[model samples]
Target: MTQHRKRDKNLGLAELVAIALGGMVGGGIFTILGISVSMIGNLTPIAIIIGGLIASLAAYSYVKLGLYYKDEGATYSFFKRTYPKSHFSAAAIGWFIIFGYISTLALYAYTFSSYAISSTEFANDIQIRKMIAIGVIGIFTLINVLSVKGMGKIEDLMVYTKLVILTIIAVVLIQHGSTSFEGFIGDMAMDAKNSSTLSILIVASITFVAYEGFQLVINAVSEMTNPDKNIPRAIYSAIGLAVLIYVVISMGALFAIPSEDIIKNKEFALAAGAGDVLGKMGTDLVILGAILATSSAISGTVFGSSRQMSVVAKDGYLPKWLAIRKKNIPINSIVGMGVMAAILILIGGLELILEFGSITFLLVSLLMAIANYKLRDKTNSSKVLTTFSILGLAIGGVLILYYEFTAKWEQMLAIVVLYAVLALGAWIYSKKNERAKKIT
Candidate 1:
């Protein structure tokens, strides 16, 4: 009880926002900027704003249900409690959400490696980058295994400090920008005339993963002070801040760098842009910002997702060994998640993991919107808004499938196969757990 009090007292609104922001902003903007710019040029900010709006729509359900149930199991447990008798529903969401976290884990670690080695001669070496990605995951996995308080403090420092560094990068880029606002507007207008609406919407749908980590806040419901008040406040505020940061950074990048450079250096575009314009110092700063961003994301994802994984295990939807906790930490679950993420880093390509994570979260968030609409009366959710959330997320999902089907059928096929395997495992566990519960 004393320990519990200490945990609650140490975390407040600031820490809660930090956790959410740490999760959302990590490696997402850095990775998405090049991709977005390639697809939409100066219109990248429009796609980002659309993604954030979609995120807010999804968050409504999370905030309402988070306040209602307040389970750190978050996506998985919330579905379980909302539909108690449906073991399959619980198991499926459990599998999807945990794997989604794993995919994002791989994404962040890979982004970290990309920026960390951007200045090195080994920049183009894929094998070396994979090694560095796995190494960072190992480092953060150990950090998470040791202590939650330690992780939180480190996360706080990284999130805030990175924000400052990112702001400075944006300002410096804009100040040194060769393009005028009028010229940018002309470029955007020309691009808008040539680019299809479907393309911009597809880019927005692709960026859903960038806003994926804000729900990590809900995973800390037990540790927070006045969760009923803080959960919604932290999640909404973090999303708002993230949208602003992403827009500023995207605009700044476009202002300073040519579209050809962004598309050419797609992987490390920001760093490349900084190198060309801001010289070595600008390049160094972007690298520093990316490293910090991805590092904090790795920490927060491991910290929050491990707890949710443990909760799912406790409910008999996963391996029971993963439920074991020492000092309120899910050691086995944390280790297991790290291993899977590392494996993904080694085997899966970055674009595959990125799209998989984006689609997985969009589907999961869509489910949350449906769940909330079902419980709207109890959660005080507005009918219009909840319905809009459902419509918005559904459209986002369709756009992703359309994009994948047209652009990358191979990756889409692989994602489908992966989901099938996960579904089979979830079904088997759901049946086993149901039988065990009946016997008892």
Candidate 2:
């Protein structure tokens, strides 16, 4: 068989940033902010800002690695190329990258389903909610299969939508406050029941989920117009903008809902916050924004992960059949990802998927950090930041993982599944490497 090679032309800066922002600011932030406020009181915004900074540092590292290598594997290729010392580590990073993509596809699939069903009482009448969710995945999957341009346009528009909604709410809360939600932070002075050091850290770890989506840009690097310059600029700009918006929205959410009500009703925290003063219209818009944000997230994830699948296919890790062309794109794997995402949606537990996805990203990020330092190439700016960012991310990851895993035994199973994927990828890569050596 002839060697197959076809690459997506570069996408513009707007498309790149849209992808990053759309992927990062999903439904979790709206919901997670509520949960964070309830637990940390007035410091909910502070906790979110902390998580945002940690996530941004990780984003900065990804930007650097993506620029340095400019390869399709994104973080996977970065680690594998940078550190040849341990093949196991390379495989681990690859597996984790794949896991993060798939898990996000799953996480946001659930979000879309919830929103689609909430539009109609009958939609949730049966187990139909899950079915609806799967249906939404199928549609987006088809879109991706058709063309990459369409997906990029859709993602970019969604990014603007999310920014507008969040911005409006922030303005409302910041300027004219009709309702005094001061009690939301009444516990700010370290009340023993809620202010335990353990609880705050636990909340930060949970908040991390709200902040980890910007790396989606690298997955589309092949389609990006200027990988060397655009990738770095777009990725960093997206992270900076998202961090600012998230902190403001988190603070607004804290001010809108009483801490007690926020804890009691985590479902529509942002809407409630909006409702406190602005009444029904404000709450409704926020809910609508949440729906749009989550939908865009699911769309971006399916689009990006499927592209990664195409990249792995080009590299010969996945079957060459996936690398074959249909309308100048990878149709088979894109549809396959859609099907996988739909199934994951049927699994129907957002919390489980979010934690699993976040942990998976952290694992890959930890590897990238180690790879940067081990490479010891300080002359390169990307590597330099990767070194420091990866280290900071690891400390944060460890703290959060310990806090999260200690409580949920189910998480151990996620880790097990995670490692299993790593082992499998490593074995496959070794086989391929051997075949290549023999051919030479």
Candidate 3:
């Protein structure tokens, strides 16, 4: 009884919010800032706001389903239970969501490596960055495998501290900016006239991946307290906070740093820009903020997604070996996720990983929205809101694909092939599950 009570109290609302925020705020802003600015120029924050709104739309279904289902498996478990009869649907979503988590893991680790080396001679050293990225993943994977409460405590420290630092960086950059408020607004107006509506919407859709981590709060349902209150509270609070942070930081960057430099530096744009404006002190601050952001993100992603992976494996949608657990922790799944993310870091480039993660999560969230609509009554979900979520998510998904097709067909081809491979794997396991069920 004592042990059970201790387990129940391991995570509270604060920790839950940290996990969600850690996941959302990590490498996302750092990774996408350069790309968004290059595409939309001064209009990046508007796209960010739209992305946040779209994320909120997607979150409705997750919150409702999370409260109703109260399952730690989160996206995979919710979809599985929602359409229990369709094994393929369950298996396919499981595959996509897990890989989506993997891609984001790679993204965060890559961003961490970029900022970690941004001030060093190895700033542009691709091989060294990849090594550092993989190394950090291993470190966090071991921490997660060690203790749940330990990881949560560390995450709270990193997430909250990074938020404070990020806010300071924004204020300093804006104060020391080269452009005044009027000038910035004028630049935005020019960009608005120059950039197309479709371009802005496409950027918004691409930024959806930055909002991908909020649903992670629901994944901690088993570990947290007061699911009825904390689930929605944590998820919504984290998303709102994320939107504010992204906007403030992006505005600061645009005000202080030139667009050409941001485009050139790409992943390390903030750190590079900070060095120019604030010198060593400013650059160091940005690097510190980024490190903490991506570190907590890595820890939170591995923690939540590994548990969900274990759940999926137990359901016979993945290798049964991954279902093994110790002390209520999915050790095998945790290790497997780290290994797979490392492999992705090695094979995929930064942009490919970013785009793939965004598209996959957008698609998975869209499906979750559809599932919520199907069981709206049971979940106490409003039909009007759920329907809107469906339409918004679907449009977001379409916009992203359109951007890929028109702008980078080669990346689009790679993404398509990757989906085909995952589909094949999901199909094979789903059939195996069918046979096992019939025999039973």
Q: Which candidate is the best by lDDT?
A: 3
Residue pairs in clash, model 3: none
What's each prediction's TM-score? 0.98, 0.86, 0.98
Candidate number with the higher lDDT (1 or 2): 1
Q: What tens digits encode model 3's per-residue C-alpha lDDT throughout 183-287?
A: 999999999999999999999999999998998888787788888999999999999999999999999899899999999998989999989999999999999
TM-score of 2: 0.86
> With candidate 3 superimposed using the best TM-score fit, by how many Å does residue 139's alpha carbon deviate from the native?
0.6
Residue 358 lDDT, candidate 2, scale 0-100: 66
lDDT of 2 by residue, 1-440 (tens): 11325666746899888877878787667656656765567776667667777777676667666766666667767776777555556655655676567767766666555544543455344367567667777877877777788888887787788789878887677555533555444545554455776676667666676666677788777667767788878877877787788877766665555567666545455565667768777867776777778778777777676666666656555666766657656687777677766666666366677777767776676776666566546415555566668766777778767766677767656666756866787678756855775798
lDDT per residue, candidate 1, 27-87, as tens digits?
7888888888878889999999999999999999999989888788999977888888889
The residue ranges of model 1 lying beyond 4 angstroms of the native Cα positions read 1-9
For each candidate, what is the lDDT? 0.91, 0.68, 0.93
Cα RMSD, model 2: 3.7
Count clashing residue pairs per candidate. 0, 6, 0
- In candidate 1, list every pair of residues with a backbone clash: none
